[model samples]
Target chain A: MRVALADDGALFRDGLVMLLEAAGHEVVGCTADGDTLVELLATEPADVAVLDIRMPPEPDGGLSTAERLRADHPELGLLFLSHYAETHYLIRVLNIGTQAIGYRLKEKVGSVEVLSDTLTRIRDGEIVIEPVLAQRLVDRPSSNRRDMLATLSDRELDVLRLMSEGRSNAGIASLLFVAAKSIEKHISSIFMKLGLPSDAAEQHRRVLAVLTFLRSVQDSG
Target chain B: MTLDTYDATGSARRRADEHWSRRRDLERQLHDGPALRIAALTLRLGLLAQKARHDVGGLPHDIEELQYQLHLIQQELRAVADRIYPPLLHEAGLGPALRELASSASVRVDAGGGRFDPAVEGVVYFVIVGVLAALPPATRTVDVVIRRDADGLALDLGDVDTGQIGAVRDRVRWVDGVAEVGDGLIGTIRVRIPCE
Candidate 1:
């Protein structure tokens, strides 16, 4: 996979380049700010662009850049790396677009497996949210009486969480050591429980719908 | 009202400005220095752990423990940095920042409004957080509303006594804003700051 990165911290950028190369992904270009990432991507296109949410031009320049990049190049994957896993950044990142996007904490993404998996999921047009943030979304106390999330059972909540983490039903099934068909059943049951309008045509879109639901829940609270 | 009082307020404002800047700088240093360096090291260690796994069929327990310890340090550093200065306040604005601050508060805070000048936001955020902290342990009910009208930004704090209003007054006054206690023993503290 071809990956571009923009982060103000030079040390972290260098380390990221090394990690990506070690993970067998091409580091197309590396820069220190969102503006430079825009320029770099124009000249050197990448399948995915990893950004630090806090960078030059503005405190949340990465968000604005992601929005622009998504507008200009719809196919490009975006993964935002932040030092802190604030749900606020996750909300903004999801607002940009649910597809081919991810928000992961910097410390957590150090693992090559996690980084590689994230890039692959993004390239596959999935929304890759950090697991911790997803767990928080599940655990947060819902003030609204009509909160659909409260309807989900513990096992259902686990499925929804894995779905939010960009895991395919099959991937989730493997992790849980369940059969593929059962995972599908659990997911469909989840969508029904959450009162998500049925749209069985596209699996990824369902994941996105769940993500959008989570975002709305976060916004309301 | 008098020159002495005016100079004192000016000096106090200057001190607040300096304090905010210092906190911001310290936050930046923590963010860009040790935080980044530690993160970089974590990345390298991750790669090393992968190699160890490939060669030894699994990660050594000590290496895993070291990585866990480093991750904890990173989290601690981030918490400290957020305390020194919330990055969200600078990145996102007062509303989101206040909501983040209020999440941990025992009282309810309906943090509404939008972006204002950074200086105005700093003062309002600082004053609100300080006031909330000073609430008595037994104090149960408190209301915080942040709104912007034709005049400027206004923060209305209900159920706070006059005693608590003094610090609120000084904090708001530093930004050339007005903080007034309503007509009751335990009244609301209304603060209005002009925003351009």
Candidate 2:
């Protein structure tokens, strides 16, 4: 994958370049802030653009840049790295777009393996959320929400948590040590229980299920 | 007329002192926490890079320690960030932010939900936090009511320590708000800030 990036932090940017190179992805452009990254992207194209959520030109310049990138190059993948895992940032990232996008903690994505997998998942047009954020949404006591979330059994909740993390059926099966077929059954059951339409495409259904979970948590907060 | 002049000068001096004290605390927090950890991480990373070239087998444990240090830096930075301006205050608005604050507060907080002017929200939110922090350690429970009405926003705090009432009054008065404290063994503070 060809990647362009922006971050005001020189050290993190340099280390990220090293990590991406080690993972075998090409770093097409590196810049300090969103403005420079925008100028670089005009000529030096990339499959994905990694950005820091807080940077120069504005505190939330990365979010503004993502909006611009979405408008100019709708096909490009976006990954936001941040030091904090606040829901507000996640909501802002999701507001830009849900597909072909990811929001991961800066420390969590330092490893080559996680970085590579995150890039691949975004390129595949999946919504990848940080696992810590996913855990918060899932671990909120069931009694707090009187919606469809309460109907999910403990095992189903586990599957929902992994699904929110952008895990595929096979990936989830491998992690949970269950058969692929069983994973499929649990997912379909989840969709039905959540009132998601059966005819919708798998990707769309997954997004809807995740959206339901998030909205319930957001409203209750 | 002379008494009024003296009162004005006294208040001005107090404000200047408070401003200076806050700056000093901020500097101390930054220097003592994330700043020191980040400097240490730079050396550790340099060492790890060298080790990676020669001793790949020992790299995993070294990397784990680096991650732990990074985590601590993040936590420290979060405290600094909250003091500057809680991200939630601007991102999610005041109501949700207050609810989040309530979740972790030592005393129970019933923060009613409603959006107001951002500046007003900031003043009110911080005032509540300040008042809660000032309460006596032995004081266990206090009820906080934040409500919005046609006229303005009202905050009713119960069981405040008498010693902190004057400070609370000054903070609220800075925003052109009225704060009335009850006279009793345990006090209550009622504040009203009009919303335009």
Highest TM-score scorer: 1
lDDT of each residue in A16-70, candidate 2, tens digit only: 8877787789999999899989888988878999998877767578999999998
lDDT of 1 by residue, B68-141 (tens): 79889988997887777777887777766765554344344666687876567788888877877777754545
lDDT by residue for model 2 over B1-196, one digit each (tens)?
5765677644754564465345435644653456444633543454354447457577766776776677667667767767755666654556666555543443445556477655566667777778878766534456667788777888887776656667767776654677887788577888897765
Candidate 2, which segments miss by more than 4 Å at Cα?
Answer: A141-144, B1-58, B76-85, B90-93, B99-123, B126-191, B194-196
Quote model 2's TM-score: 0.75
Q: Provide the lDDT at B96 for model 2.
A: 61
Place model 2 in a CAPRI quality band. Answer: incorrect
Question: Candidate 1's interface RMSD, please?
Answer: 2.6
TM-score of chain B of each: 0.76, 0.67
Each candidate's lDDT (Cα)?
A: 0.78, 0.74
> Tens digit of lDDT per residue, candidate 1, span A75-188?
999999988777677778878998899998888877778789889999989888888778766665333423566777888778877887888888999998999899888887
What candidate 1 gets wrong by more than 4 Å, as runs, is A145-147, A199-205, A216-218, B1-6, B57-61, B101-112, B116-120, B126-143, B149-152, B158-189, B193-196
